[model samples]
Target: MNIQEYIESGILEQYALGELDDAQRAQVERMATEHPEVQAELEDVQRALNAYGEAHALTPPPGMKERVLANWQAAIQSEPGQAPAAPATEPVVRQLTPPRSEPAAAEIAPSRVSWSMAAAVALLLLSAAANLVFYNKWKQAENDLAVAQNQQASLASTMQAVNKNLTYRNQELAVLRSEQFKTVALLGTPAAPDARARVLYNPTTKAVYLDVRKLPAPPSGKQYQLWALDQGKPVDAGTLAAATVAGDSLQQMKDIASAQAFAMTVENEGGSPTPTLSTMTVLGKM
Candidate 1:
């Protein structure tokens, strides 16, 4: 248990006010016995209560002594058989009609004003404490809301990315299954004996897609580019995206209107207008 949090929870104040049930009082006592800080705080709360009462204690009105003396004399003079005006023994009746005192009134005015001001200050303190507690709760609620909104946004972003990946895979699956597309397997060149890839072509639509089976990681600042051979002349197809080069997925390259052969060669970050024949990695005849 957090001792400071427990102390500030106002349970000690309730205990000081004698508002706790027997079970609650026992619990507080047990805690106080176990924790010296709790015991000290409980003592301070009790002392503050006692001080407030003593500060606000009522003083006897002036001439109280004279009134009591007068009542005592009257009670003694009453006929013995009458029980000495039975109610005369009560001091409350005499106290209600205290004789007006100019000096006493003068002294009481400042005390009354001081007591009223003290009461106002006490009320202000209580109000301030209540506001402080409410403000802390409001701040905690705001923090919790912000955290929840961020988590919800993160979850939404993750779901969108997953859905996009699923859509791309579905399209790739359709292209692989369709009979309209012709598959061309490109065998590795002498430069790279193990490199292999396949190209899918739809002659009617002139569409082209590349699916890499294996490819070496490119050198820094270099990328793989595809070319279409038509009548012994090379036409630039397009460069591969990193995902395609990594064999992560099928990549749709630039459209090819006509071609007798297809090949890949290493180029700069962007493809060159003409292929570097010496850097050719794979070639295939359709």
Candidate 2:
């Protein structure tokens, strides 16, 4: 075989581009090992290809890769006899030589390498696009679920508060409407001239309920206490909560078997064992 003619046949270019079958590639490698000229020519072909790729590098327009990949895939899937005609586009690389009328059947064609590489790139881009779409949909679903859970929690808390308020109001209404309860008037004393309150007593059940009409706010570390005076001696009733002092609603007190009068006094927090006479705010007889 003429070595110079073989070098000029563009066979080295096909070898560099990996367009040769395994048996043909081994034959080329054997030639390069035996002749320093073939080895040097192979290296030159590889360098030229690298330089050409760099010089022709282009930043494609946005979304162009996807469009080209779609078209390429559709063409590949078409039946062999009914393949779509290629669209007019710029040539990727110039042909090394004009086609001959008759060529050796064993020689690899350049078109095979071009089509193989295009198919590989198209499939890769399509896979990447599919993954991105699925990931975005998953994240959106997670965000929607979080928002729904937060709204449900807020609604549950509001309903609980409303139910508790309704129960308190119902109890207050029942006490006011009962016919068995006797109402008592507690007049304000000189210390709190504007302070006034009332007491409801059920004689049969011995239930006592205190209702403040208007009262002065207790000092810090102090609370209002109710006393039942049975025959002039003060009996401990119960201490008032902050809501009761504000006259928000009626408050149930410790039951009293018998009492001639009811009075209110300011005492230390949680109330004292005995009433403090100087702190008396109101007094009323039943």
Candidate 3:
């Protein structure tokens, strides 16, 4: 590549910006050594960038000058792979100040101080930014964990409800299949013609179940109660607590023996010992 043409292609600008990879950097360094023009251009770019950075740097920390001078001196004296108490061009201190026509002590001190201060400020800014990034990441992790726990709880609750329904269905099927139990149908009265229910009972065990099909919502203070009718007398079996029909519509009622007939009545809350004959909604005989 033509050296002048390569310089104008913007690779030097990238070097000044510190954006070049190791290979690109090596090539640029080699070209600069071979061409004095390339060397001068590279120096001028570095000086301009350094000047811009120094101008905008924050105030230096207290006693920074003393520490910087101490560390720098120790570095040159104790550096490895070099002669101890090294012979050099103008002690390391003299090289710290930017080259100027005056080269006065007053001019050099402030320049060196500014360079040290700029480095300290850069380190502080980097530390603060890193802390902020970590804090945000921690908060996001906590939010994700909370969401996962809620989803887990919802899934567990759904599983429990499914298992409960499955158990009820198994018991319901078992009772229906037994030949020892009798099935009775209760038809709605004129008061509630659309209401219908059924009962399955085992005479041997006196276990009874009521199946409510089409019943209106009960009044706020009233409920439905089941009864066993035998020998012209009505005995309280149990109350069907639910006001409206629910899944399967099957609920175990009070168990009794010698029940020749069955009945249902609308009564007060907690049910009454006797059926309210006036509010009877259904009746059936064996």
List TM-scores for all candidates, in order: 0.61, 0.57, 0.59
lDDT of 2 by residue, 182-225 (tens): 99999999999999999999889999999999999999999999
lDDT of each: 0.91, 0.87, 0.83
lDDT of 3 by residue, 14-122 (tens): 9999999999999999999999989888898899999999999997799997787768667755874464445585466346643333345667789889988999999
How many angstroms is residue 5 displaced in model 1 relative to the true structure, after the best TM-score fit?
93
Q: What overall lDDT, based on C-alpha atoms, would model 1 receive against the true structure?
A: 0.91
Worst 10 residues of 2 by lDDT: 89-98
Poorly placed runs, candidate 3 (over 4 Å): 1-112, 243-248
The residue pairs that clash in candidate 1, if any, are: none
Q: Say which candidate scores most in lDDT.
A: 1
Task: Please give, for residues 1-286, the per-residue lDDT of candidate 1 as tens digits.
Answer: 5999999999999999999999999999999999999999999999999999899988779999778767865775574465445576656634653434434675898999999999999999999999999999999999999999999999999999999999999999999998999999998999999999999999999999999999998899999999999888999999998989889999999999999899999999988999999999999989
Using TM-score as the measure, the top candidate is 1
Q: Under the 3 Å rule for N, CA and C atoms, how many clashes does model 3 have?
A: 0
| Backbone clash count, each prediction separately | 0, 0, 0
